[model samples]
Target: RKLPGAAGAADEGAADAIRELEEQLEQATQSLRAREEESKAAEKRGQALNSKLRRAQAALAQARAEARRHAEAGAHQDQELRDQVASLSSELDRARRKLKRAGKRHEEDKADKAARKELQEDFERRGTELYKMNDKLREAVERADLLGKALAMQADEVEQLRKHVGEADEWRAKCDRLSMAEAAAAVG
Candidate 1:
């Protein structure tokens, strides 16, 4: 009934489990590293997109500046005015779309600010409540400690009273024995 290998079986099982855990940990580490690289790539892409957006905005501003220069250079040219009119029409459409997007972004920003403000207020309120609860808990613990000390003192007093009662009983027993002996002697 006693297999010698049975003792090593438990150790072998534990070793296998440790090996499997090590493999799992290695896989998790690799996965996390991959995700971190992906996150960095995404950040780069976002920065590139923002850079392109800024370049496009600068180009639009340059176009407007150029149009102003052209108008100033030729007040009497009918052809320039016609070209300017067509360009202005196209610019107006793009400007309208940009304005709409800006308005939406502004509203979203406003809502985000409100949410953040509410969250901060809630955190402060909860923190105040937590502090108050902590104070009450401390006071309760102090009261318990004081009561424990009082109880210990009372217990000591009770023990002393018990000792005194034992002594009194011993003295009474001795007196009774002496009285019985004296009465017997008198009778004799």
Candidate 2:
């Protein structure tokens, strides 16, 4: 009877151990399932993070490319601006030269105008002198005409006086002859 009682107690202890082991195994399996779920969540989060990182990197590369393009455009604009400035400077120099030439031409025109004015004044003075000389010449011509008329009248009067003297001489001769003849008769 002691041997059977001892075997029965050992069998009860073995069954209790087996029940405890089964409970531990069930708890471990539940814990492993929870861990596997957590691992899957972590993998999804990592993939999301990698996708976000790739997108961020792509955006950064695009931004860098845009910045390089903008920089190149700015350089091109700067070069164009420099060319424009050079062109403007050249235009300004040409304009300044043209202005200087125009100023010189204006001075020459002023001088020419002054010379023309002086010539005009001289011509006017000469014209006035010529008018006065013409008037003097007309007066001299009128005086000469009057003197010629008076000289012609004096020549006609001298001719008439000479004829009267000739007639007087003939009459004197005749008177002397008559006197001489009367004296001869008385003597005879």
Candidate 3:
């Protein structure tokens, strides 16, 4: 009876050990499955990050290219502006020369106008003097004509007086002859 009871007790202990090992194995399997799901989630996140990094790199390259293009265009525009400034400066110089010439011409014209005015005044003065001289000459001619008429009248009066004197002398001679004849008759 003692031997059979000991064998039955050993058999019960062995059955309990087997049940504990199976429970431990099931827990280990569940832990392993949870770890696999976590690893797959981490791998998907890494792939998404890689895709974003590639896109960012491409955007940076395109931005650099655009900046270079803008710089080249700005340089060309600066050169064009310099050329325009030079052209404008040349035109300004030409305009200044033309203005200087015009100013000199204006001064010459003013001088000519002053000379013409002086000549006109001299001509007017000479004309006035000539008119006065002509008036004086006309008056002198009128006086000469009057003097000539008076001299002609005086000559005619002198000739008439001489003829009357000649007649008086003839009469005086005839009277003397008659007296002499009367004296001679008385004596006879």
Candidate 4:
């Protein structure tokens, strides 16, 4: 009975150690699975960020190309404008020289034109003088009319003076009759 009891106890202890070792192994396997999931998520995020960087680089290259094209077009336009300005300047210089020669010929014509202008001015001055003389004649006619009216007034005043002299003679005769009557009364 003793030998059987000892052998049964040894078997029970070995079974408990085996059960503990199995629990530890299951815990380690769960931890390894969680770490694998985290690694996969990190890899996906890295790929997305790399794709965004590539897109940004491509857009930057396109913008640079557009800027270069604009610069080249502007340079060509500026060169064309410069060439046009140069040609216009040369044409202007030629026109100025031709105008100077025409001006020299115009100077020769100016002497004849100046003589004609002087004759026209003399005629204008004579016409102005005639107009002034006509104005003076009109004023003289007005003065003659005024003098004729004054002479007519003087003639009317002379007739009034003659009437006044006749009235004075009549008054003198009446005064003489009154004086004779007064003398007769005194004598009687």
Per-model TM against the reference: 0.45, 0.51, 0.43, 0.45
Clashing pairs in model 2, backbone N/Cα/C closer than 3 A: none
List where candidate 3 sits over 4 angstroms from the true fold.
Answer: 1-4, 91-188
Each model's RMSD to truth, in Å?
39.5, 80.9, 82.7, 66.7
**Candidate 2 deviant stretches above 4 angstroms:** 1-3, 102-188
Best by TM-score: 2
In terms of TM-score, how similar is model 4 to the real structure? 0.45
Model 2, 27-133: lDDT tens digits are 65565556556555555555555555555555555555655555565556556656655665575556556756788867555555665566567556655655665
Who is ahead in lDDT, 1 or 3?
A: 1
- Per-model CA lDDT versus the true structure: 0.55, 0.55, 0.52, 0.54
* lDDT for each residue of candidate 1 in 104-173, tens digit (9 for 90 to 100): 8675555556655665675566556556655554555555455555555545554554555455455545
lDDT digits (tens) for residues 153-183 of candidate 3: 5445444444444444444454344444434
lDDT of 2 at 178: 44
Sorted by lDDT (best first), the order is 1, 2, 4, 3
What is the alpha-carbon lDDT of model 2 when measured against the actual structure?
A: 0.55
lDDT of 3: 0.52
- Cα error, residue 64 of model 1, in Å, equals 78
Per-residue alpha-carbon lDDT of candidate 4 for residues 1-188, written as tens digits (9 for 90 to 100)? 33368798876776676565555545544554554454455445445545554554455455555545555655565566566556655755565567567787575455445645654675566556556655554555555455555545545554554455455445445545544554444343
In candidate 1, the residue pairs with backbone N, CA or C atoms under 3 Å apart (3 or more residues apart, or in different chains) clash, namely none
